[model samples]
Target: MTSDTVPVPPGGEILRYAAFTTRPDGGNPAGVVLDASGLSTERMLAIAAEVGYSETAFLIPGRAEGTYTVRYFSPLLEVPFCGHATVASAVALAERAGPGHYVFATPAGEVPIEVDKDADGVLRATLTSVEPHVEEAGEADVAEALALLGWSPEDLDAALPPRIAYGGARHLVLAAATRDRLARLAYDFDGLAAYMTARDLVTLQLVWRESEDVFHVRDPFPVGGVVEDPATGAAAAAFGAYLRELGAVTVPATLTLHQGDDLGRPGLLHVELREGDARVRVSGAAVAIP
Candidate 1:
């Protein structure tokens, strides 16, 4: 059904939360429909589009308590998974149900989420990603992506090669040689969106490594019908896997990601990798937008 024909349920409230930051204006904002049992796919899409956030999450209660079947939709289409929205939804649930563990059954796979209050009395959520993998990006595809972004091969960081990374969703991981290069992010939206659509990529994880464990990043999400994602938790999870697979980071280590600074909505993402597990864990704080 077209967005114009989609129906809004009576008194259906959409909770707004900013994921990855305690402040409402900081992290990536996501719409959480706590009970979307009656909503159709088209209805969910229309709601997300109306919300105008990068993504929104709809939750349907599972047979067991503390377990939910979740769906994520960008303004344009449904995505396999969305980390920020998961964080937002988990925290939202915690506020109503009390903090603890919750499992989300997403299109990609099952994700376990843990919610707890920190020392500062702020609620934080950590999500264990589905099994992740990294694959080599075809040289031709990389060149095309770079061309669309107006980036030259020389602007790339040779240390961190281009690759396709997946934690819950897929992202093209590209590293910039300098912080300056990463900061300048004007790209051909239409062309890049087409490229990403052809490859089934969710976003381009453009990054600049500051230290072994700290990095600054950005994500261009034209295919999702957003100019950019201020803070991308899914991409951060994918990046954690990328670092482990590339042997760029020590196992059982925690890494820090700084994002959305350029957009004036700075946020932080904590990524953890355990020695025995291939799955990545992404943690962030979320606050309700009043």
Candidate 2:
């Protein structure tokens, strides 16, 4: 219960971190409210469906200082960028304004963020995506998202080839030629939430590729109504730009990504990639979920 005794509740203080793990039940719990200025969008989608947590950031401060204006809610709507609620709202604003850089602006752009504090003191953050692309997933939308996840096309992964990336929101990468077919996640959640609301898609990363910089993800977010999303970090920053546009990592590389161990909540998503940066950074460590 640290982070300066965070708790409030009633009509304000949401907090509740967890992002990419470091305990506090592993990762991906989000729901920080910070200030949420005048909040509305139907009361921030009713406080993100009463803080159910698949995402729930809300900020709204910007005009200088560290900057904010974030949004993200996903109990069933409003999402333009989430990434474990922007790393649990940048370590809940670096435990109340302390860590470094910040900037958020989001509706699918200007992300920035930084935080810092590690050496065991914890509090990591990172962010940085937005300005990613990666199309080519239409083969009838990858056979209707592999027939709503009962999977097929020979369990995929012919060297990771399904794409639909995007670093701030749209996902749908696929992969999975094992790891028990990406840990058997039963899908069909309302037919993949009506096939990801007619193509905007929000999750379905689902990888596997335990080598070349290690990997193993899983997202399947039934279009944000949530069914699975333990530590997405915007689909690990659109799968590090779909593994460097499918060259499968090379540039300054960093990768790692090992999302929520088959749902027992394991979490860990470093993913770097520098050398002439094309966006994608995504770090991790965010606790305070007591």
Candidate 3:
């Protein structure tokens, strides 16, 4: 049956958690429905809007233990996969069952998440992405995107160029020549939303390289009905793939992404690409939003 035709159960209780940080005020907040067995598609969208986060996760019991079927919804639409919400939901489950491994059957694919406590006594979850791929973005498309973002072609980093990258979802990757260029992000909401909608893009992964392994990034998520996403796990995963594809980073490398600082909600994302592995791994800590 088609996704739209699938039956949705009734609504369940919703919990709130912030992913990628230890402090409740930090990281990206997401709504988590631990038992969404009864939620319908329409109802889920309503719940997501009510939660008012970038995205919310709904979990249904899976066939096996430590497994669950998951769905992600933004305020306005259902997404194929949501990284922050996935991390948040896994930690929520881990808190109840103790830190361990959990399998989430997302619309994108089977994602395996491992939750464990670090030395700092923080609960962190690492998610293995599905097979990732990158494609060269058309020059015309890049021009249009730059216009919508109020960015000039000269502001773009020629070394990184522009590309469309995908892990669980697609993102348009744009590298800025300088941190200053990336920081002054003022965009036309309607124009960008239209462009992104036409391309089925989740966000624009605007970034600037800080050092060999450190980078500053931001995501413009007009498609998700959010002005900006403080911490974007999906984009980070896709960026890992983008770097690997472009040979920008050596394999078996780990990178640190700092985001949401400009928005005053600082977040950190750890991305790792293992040797001989095609899928990227993203890890971060989460906290319950009280």
lDDT of 2 by residue, 97-166 (tens): 7899988988997898888997878888898898898888879889888988889999988988998998
lDDT of each model, Cα atoms only? 0.94, 0.84, 0.92
TM-score each candidate.
0.97, 0.35, 0.96
Highest-scoring model, lDDT: 1
Model 3 spans > 4 angstroms off? 1-12
Better of 1 and 3 by lDDT: 1
**Model 1, position 191: C-alpha lDDT score:** 94
Better of 1 and 3 by TM-score: 1
Off-target runs (Cα >4 Å) in candidate 1 are 1-6, 9-11
In candidate 3, the residue pairs with backbone N, CA or C atoms under 3 Å apart (3 or more residues apart, or in different chains) clash, namely: 9-38, 9-39, 10-38, 10-39
Instruction: Score candidate 2 by TM-score against the native.
Output: 0.35
The number of the candidate with the highest TM-score is: 1
